[model samples]
Target: MPYLPARAVATLRLLFATLLLAPLAAQAQAEPDGDNSQSPYFSVHSDDPANDRLPLKSTQVRARVLGVIADVTVTQHYRNEGSRPLEAQYVFPASTRAAVYAMQVRIGERQLNASIREKQQAKQEYEAGKLAGKTSALLEQHRENVFQMNVANILPGDEVAVELHYTELLVPTDGVYRFVFPTVVGPRYNGALATGSGTAEPWIATPYQCTAATTDAVGAAAIDESAPVFDLQVQLATPTPVRELVSPSHAIDIDKGADNQSRVRLAAATTIANDRDFILDYRLAGDRIESGLLLSKGSEENFFLALVAPPKAAPSQLIVPREYLFVVDISGSMHGFPLDTAKVLLQRLLAGLRPSDRFNVMLFSGSSSLLAPDSQPANADNIARALTLLDTEMGSGGTELLPALRQALAVPGDQERARSFVVITDGFVTVERDAFELVRKHLDQANLFAFGIGSSVNRQLIEGLARAGQGEPFVVLDKASAAEQAERFRRMIDAPLLTHVQARFEGLDTYEVEPPALPDLFAQRPLVLFGKWRGEAKGRLLIEGQQAGGAYRVELPIRADQAQAENQALALLWARHRVASLTDQETLEGDFAYSQAILDLGLKYHLLTPYTSFVAVDEVVRTAPGTSPAATPQPLPLPQGVSPLAVSPLTVGAAVPSTPEPSTWAMLLIAALGGLLLHRRGPRGAGGTV
Candidate 1:
């Protein structure tokens, strides 16, 4: 295998590749015969391209070439490690931009180079001619060149390795060159089923960097340097190699060991420096962030403020004993990760409740149920039983948010406390305006806190409900995030820091600020405010927040010496009041324009809207008002590009062409012809060695 020179072998590899791909171009057109049914087991079929999801009978690949000039010949190997028989079909996407010198397939113990040929079909010729320098033919659908044959049968426990050897023209470029191997799970003829699973891992390696440049020079600010001769190594796990270790920023050396395990070592080599900063990010397994802080020659004091909110307000402060109610959504979609995570968070919140606090739990689906016949104060035995009962409940039925909200509010609970309702859901419904109106009507001293789950949660509805109920809203993106949000809830239940926060600045003209009214601050959630600032610095302002029974007043001395501090103090005051105003809208005396601005901004930026989301690219501009000063211009639509792996179930057949090639007698004819021809010719001698 290692007998030939590299230069002479490169020429021979190009020659054989051309011969194996000519026929596919002549008969590439296939139509769709739609049949949609759920089949438990995978099917294999030939002839119909639409049936390409299935496998075919069997195949064989043979390759060879001698490179006389380079003094090295490429060696190839093939293996079949698959459960069912693999009908291997190799198709080199016809390329006019770059010539493929050689290709190989690995099946069981044999490795052979693929036969290549120039596709003469009119469409293939036209496409090949048009693709002058493009690296990919994703936009062009017709041009193809490659060989695909089937392995009549591969029993359960099988593996295949295909090694191709050829001299590829090393094209020099200034930017980072990325060579991505296709890993889509599709037809073999498409040359897309390139990913592995379970214990095996597929790897790709490239040689050294050629040059170096700064991030700005390349437009990717995060990358400090772009080297010319960059060595890139990538691996995807599969059955043969069960575990593979790789780092995003370095090269990993992989070697097969004697004990059925692969050893991988990642080594970092080059460092790129930039004008702004140079920092190394490393998370050694599960360790927290370890940072190095450089100090100036003289400075020593590290002024830090750790604000720990107290548990429960004092009697003299703004006393708002909340009448707490829980509305839990148990819909069918929440059955999996969503509902399970929600249950754990709710139990934590319940545990934080004090003896005097009144609460009730309402579970909802198509119908709603209460934890107890009536609301009761939190007690050790009752709260514990409530948590246990929630575990036994399962999510099912349609999401009926309207009725659920109504039932939760109407539930006879602790009316004596300042009422507050907590609703947890994946936000799967679209009950818009009506739901908001209902929340507003039923809302009183009780504010609403909404916890949302899943990627498609209706942020608008949940946030809107919270706004109406004068509460807070949080989202759980995945299982990991559930704990954080749960902690926020626990903190809120533990104590109320400040209540009824209001601010009036004398130095500047009135400007926009968020959270008009402040809510009682809990330990977990940080109190942040948003708004525009204006005017010159002047006098000191007053800071007043109710603790337990009485109001605590502090003078925020705004010295001209500390101008920035004064403005920030003013901004913080504005933010705190804005938040309070949002929740306490019913008590406001003016128009709802301030709250409206918050809602408008949320929709514009696709922020955590109470009820909506910019689900698709088009939704980015759909509801945002064009005339508004805050409106962002919609981007122009671009042509769709092909993806590697169809990861999302939603993207399955939509991106690919609807019509699939039919598997029938025609496939058998091509297979028989190719097999007979290949056998008769018997792989033109040894052309190249690995």
Candidate 2:
């Protein structure tokens, strides 16, 4: 966090091709655990040496979340080894219901957090009578959409195993069930899609494999591979057309039947090779919200199943009270455009604060300070004072985030009101775990929101912290993103339209479906949900909200396959917000299920996933003399200052290529050795040999 002098900054900028962005890794260190024999630590790495961090080996894990129950089992192996008992710290990417529950941690008899088992027992006993065939009103409240962990204490030479359990509520939704996972971004796993439907149970799973391409003399070459693709089969009660769109792969196949029914298939492709994530966008779209619902008719294990629905009335706005704390980093890194932009945004945020709302600003660097001595009702004088502080000489120093967070949490407010802390930073350090843990400790009262600045900041850290805080993380990719985020922030802070919202569907005994948890209603946006629906006839649909004083409920009429477009749009907006919020919370579900589907579709339709290659591999696999015989594999260019074992983003989702020894350097060294030997002998024999 040290701020380089102005001249130093300029000189460094001139000397390096890129600005002095944040370093991606932290130096390893040992800390004391209560147990002397066991100590555990966690670190992240990337194969991209340019990143300069420990590479995160690609892993496939199993995870699930439901009402009050959260579980994750990592099939991946741990590589840490030592003779003493090591404190294993599992890092959770976001906040979850597990935090409040006793998490059962098992790594071969070293039970770290067994209190989780007790919590589960208590939950089961608490709901023994009404547990079956019932959903809780507070169900969604317990569900965390993002999960990351840190384990402490482990013995040396012992194989590490991981299992976590907690509880959460699944909010019911009216829209299609959608899940997203990021394998990598923008490149390798580019433009992938998958689609299928089933009844009874819903699940999506994908197995990922990694590999590389073969080439010749030049440093560049085309990557090609052929592997077994997973099978994708879904049974439909009626004819339903499935369409997939993937990058590095494109297709258009239209089908029509004599019955006058029509189905359209679409796909696309891209050129960049990167270890990008696969995004799954699925929904049952039709002319209306009702009727067009398709139910699961195949095996009960299909991941997606739709059923008949109803119409939703237009939503009304309600007022929600808020207590906010703004945390700003005024380190030397912010001396340039970063600081200026932050000032403007702060001003906008202050302007949007209401007189009834409570707020404070905590600016940190080498030290932390508040805008005022205590929390103040937003007013002209206080707002002006906060802005004035921003204009003062802000110096750069080492980032001490813990103290700043402690100060922000110390701000007092009504516990019932929605509390929030917004952190703004360029995210340029390695204190990811400590900072996030601090936020986690005080998350019960305030939601943490983050606005990440800079082009090369560690998004994982920024987004991870926000997720842990049950807050939203905004990225300022540039001016455009900054402006857009500012506006979004303004809207979120304006007011809450509703609180503790709920939807109840009456009349329909033969139906089977689950909905997303109802979310906290925000005035800035509407609420939307996606879920499954089934069977005939329904009664009146009811929507309820808890206001500051009284409860509000509205009853709407039902239809078969038709959905109200206006209501659906509002729901879409709500859905987007909920997903973003879950991502920030790191409790959102992973995209593995959807990713598997995309990979399958990519393979069947020749699409590209981190695991699926879009380029034609048929010829490469059929290596014939006529066809370019697997061109003699050439060595990949080694990055300077990087080790041969470094993971390459290009190689993610594929097999690792064998590295060849440096041929030119080896030849030169050998030739030098031979000449030295000859010279030594000649010197010794000289005239005698002649």
Candidate 3:
């Protein structure tokens, strides 16, 4: 027998323990796979279909557009079909820029308007009211673009309608205006399971429904059979004639009305699947851009929004060499339509590049790799090679976007040339703030454009990336628009509409502008400014910027006599913009002061936010506390065009699986072999030692 060293024995013990416990750990963390026979964690019984169905009954969206601002109303109907009185919670999505100000709950003939409260106080009040068997509702903000609504004490066969109202500014890019209504919240991949009891965000712990069939196929069938019904209508009024009205996401019928007004509604027999986003795009007739000011007076304060369109720059012939880096996501969430769309978009973008431009393609999943170590000229051969690389390397993996972005940003290019980075992805990862910070840090080095590709892309991530990188965000919902989006991108990158922008306010007291500093304007987008004003509004708003060869300026007169105090929405919209600005500053500075400011703004304005929530309660008790039904987690529809494989059973939070380095494995093997060698060599003999 041979003797082994102490370190060898310890290493062997650890190796055996790891090998034995890995399987158990995996089983404990295993996600639901829509299989009842194989899963031992939860039992699935053959029960009533009514009990298994989601409590959501119907959803209706109505919109009214006046000039560049839109007022939207969303109403959701919920019914308790089961025997027990249940508390229903539904997680939903909204536009990142939407300023939600009002919410109401309708029960039969009675309607209750929800009030804003601090998040903790609101939760306490709602919980107390629920335990008392009273009917109540609470709306909380989970993320900038995601919200959760909780309706409590809904008796069997009873129905409740929840209506939310919001306002948003519509800013067009390249003469095209788009309005999107998101229907679903995609499953998030959390790296770790939540522990401890907290009602701060109960929806985050909602269970995901998985099925043996593919998400697309099963989702479509489920939507056709049991999906909640939606009736969407929009009344659009433009200052100019509505030249073109199109719904690329759904089939909609548009009817022209009097005075540049039009009515739009979904076509007949079209099912509103919660999986995809509904988008409406329209172009105003003629090339003229409208620039004006909107004034709204509140009882306590006055707010104003100014819009200024820059003059188009004449075509220049300097033709400076440009470097473009394209970073594409091959993550599992982007396995199907998203990846295909990216391929087509990348091809179109590459084809649009000139021979003098330098380009590189980087594909990222669990790791990132470039088509070339250095950027190559956009020649035919290089473009062909890049296409081949994309085709061969396309596959599903984890989303490691931060590392890929770092890799792309690290690649040095000619300082004289304008460097641009284009990120194409479904934007499913949770590390959005990290990516934003990284881009902001390197923004001076390169401009980054984000192309969000999917039926329901993550708007917050895509928009935040662009804002941090001082670029524009483009959303491509379908394949038909890929070429058009690519062309838009080329035109935007060719030359900026306005650079070195500076705004001067003459004879008007203005403070706390939403965006303290203005970035260069790209494409045909108008310059929008929101701020608070005191004293008389009689002042000249002057906007000056640099164009191709010289400077340009525009001025607009503001008058206080035209201010209307009835428009209280302006105050809420201003608060929303201020909150957004503070959030961005929080990301950049990582300071508690910014968070405090945002919280104060949300509370004062009654806006739903991470720190503030809306809660309402009925004074009379409806049901006994002991007989209350359990809270049921609502299931979300899978985003359209996403495959089941992209959302594997264990994809909660879509956390990237940790992989050990090959060197570590090699070192472990070497240590084990050394231990065996030591054992074979045997212990030192007493006689040899003497």
Best TM-score among the predictions, by candidate number: 3
Cα lDDT of model 1 by residue, 1-690, tens digit: 224446445644554333222322221222112221110011112343322222221221121111100111222111233332222322222111112233344444544333322222322422332222111011111211111222212223434333332211111111111121211111111111121101111100000111222222112223322111112222222223233233332344665555333433334443321111111111122221111111111121111111122223333323345557788876544654567777877876787676777778888765678888777778888888778877865454445677777777677655467677888986544343456667777666467888876433545556667767666777664556667677766655544556666544455333454445455653323233334433443444444576555675544333333433322223222333333345245223334545555444334322221211111011112111312111011111000011101011111122211111122223544565454444445445663322
lDDT of 3 by residue, 628-651 (tens): 555765666667776443443432
Predicted structure 3, TM vs. truth: 0.85
The candidate maximizing lDDT is 3
Which portions of model 3 miss their true places by more than 4 Å? 1-52, 192-223, 626-628, 651-690
TM-score (C-alpha) between model 1 and the true structure: 0.39
> Ten residues in a row with the worst lDDT in model 2?
196-205
What lDDT does model 2 reach? 0.39
Candidates 2 and 3, the one with greater lDDT: 3
* Per-residue lDDT of model 2, residues 1-690, tens digit only: 334446544544453312111111111122112222111111222233222121112233333422112233333233233333222221222222222222333344444332211223323422331222111000111112222222222223445443332222222233322122222111000111121111111000011122243322211223322211111111111123223212211132334444323332333222112122222222333423332222222222211122223223233355566777889977544544556667777777778777877788888865688877767788899889888987763334434566677777877767767788889876544345456767787767877888865433446557668757755666554444466677777654554345576766676333212334554543222233334344543555566786544576766555544432232222222222333343333323334434444333323322112223211001111111222110110111111111111211222222211111233324544565454445445654554431
Ranking by TM-score: 3, 2, 1
